[model samples]
Target: TLVKTKGKLSFQEPKTKGSIRTIKVPDLAIQTLKAHKLKQKEIKLAASSAYKDHDLVVANWTGSMIDPADINADFKIACKFANVPQIRFHDLRHTHATLLLQLGENPKVVSERLGHADVSITLNTYSHVLPTMQEDLAQNFNVAMQNIKKKSL
Candidate 1:
């Protein structure tokens, strides 16, 4: 990640091998991304000769790396606009993991998305949400057994 300072931006590679894995995005996200790409096309046309064609998914209209401070400021403004609690940009990662776990996504999948070295880390980090998932699983099992018995008769 690169952080923009007054004079320059700093860059560094991931500290661990686990951070290099790809994330599987859902269809809805792909759709939204396509829409965003279309918007970027409009922006590129507007910027015309000045736009750098680096092919960034998220960048300034001139196709430059956006400033970190600007991203944070925009995030804060968006939070206010959406009437959500004020949270730092880093908090979104935690929120994404928590919401997905609570919604019963596979722990291994979540771990991969989070770039955790192993699934155990994801399970341990979100163990509090597991009890409810366990209960739901048990209920689903009961329903399945009932359906089997009815079909057998």
Candidate 2:
């Protein structure tokens, strides 16, 4: 939705007033997408005459927009199979942001990838992740203060 691959998917305007963004896909998701693409191609060939044609990244058996409800149902089933915690689909996005922030990633980088119009948008959306970094900030401040005091002495 952010990067237009071959101009196939273009975002002429931001989703919101502050929504221009680009993001890197993790290796796992990329690989999974590749696999899905291959499978989709196969399915498309096999059922070319049986279904309507659409080139969506993901789709239903009939090559149509998968209903939002169906997606949630499938997500829940997959989560149950994986023994994952009871997090909503939106929670996955939060988890991704939280992990990146906790890992000390640059907010600018993360925010851009999340397709936020600006760093502040990304920061605001994931502000909860910043609290965990307070300890690190405080420790650095203490060290800097001690250095200044020693120099003055």
Candidate 3:
């Protein structure tokens, strides 16, 4: 993709107008990208005689468009080798959304990242986790009630 930056870096376009957003990268991801960029530069220079600029973050060694199917296949094999249980690559998206909800992220924030039609989608998908959060809140509610009762006496 073209480097369509707003200020410092560009990102994949949101699927819809409602979906457009900026996400902060973790420190580890930033450092990893720096190392990867340096290595990519070396690789490109070495293959300069045959390389073509494809402008993708990851591509075939000859700088051509990497087949999506081949990448998926490779990913599957790597997942299996790493002893990860079977899960679709798409599942990672769902996993991320669920993790965010478990961490008590605002539903609106999680919804935007997943490019959901709305926050309701994020809530519905994670209602099971929400119930546990409600249980924790109930304890706080009880404490508040006790405090109010003591004040009245």
The better-scoring model by TM-score among 1 and 3 is 1
Write the candidate numbers in order of decreasing TM-score.
1, 3, 2
Highest TM-score: which candidate? Answer: 1
Q: State every prediction's TM-score relative to the real structure.
A: 0.78, 0.71, 0.71
lDDT by residue (tens digit), candidate 1, 82-139: 9999888878998999899988888898998999988999999889888999998999
Cα RMSD of all models vs. native, in order, equals: 2.7, 6.6, 6.9
**Candidate 1 ranges beyond 4 A from true positions:** 4-7, 134-153
Model 3 spans > 4 angstroms off? 1-15, 139-153
What would the per-residue lDDT of candidate 3 be over residues 13-113, giving only the tens digit for each residue? 55677656677868998999888777777878999878887675676676666555566788788899999976766677788888888787889988887
Candidate 1 vs candidate 3: which has greater lDDT? 1
Query: What tens-digit string does per-residue lDDT give for candidate 2 at 18-122?
Result: 454345688999999999988887887788877576677868666666655566788888899999876676678778887888888899988866667789988
Model 3 TM-score relative to the real fold: 0.71
Better of 1 and 2 by TM-score: 1
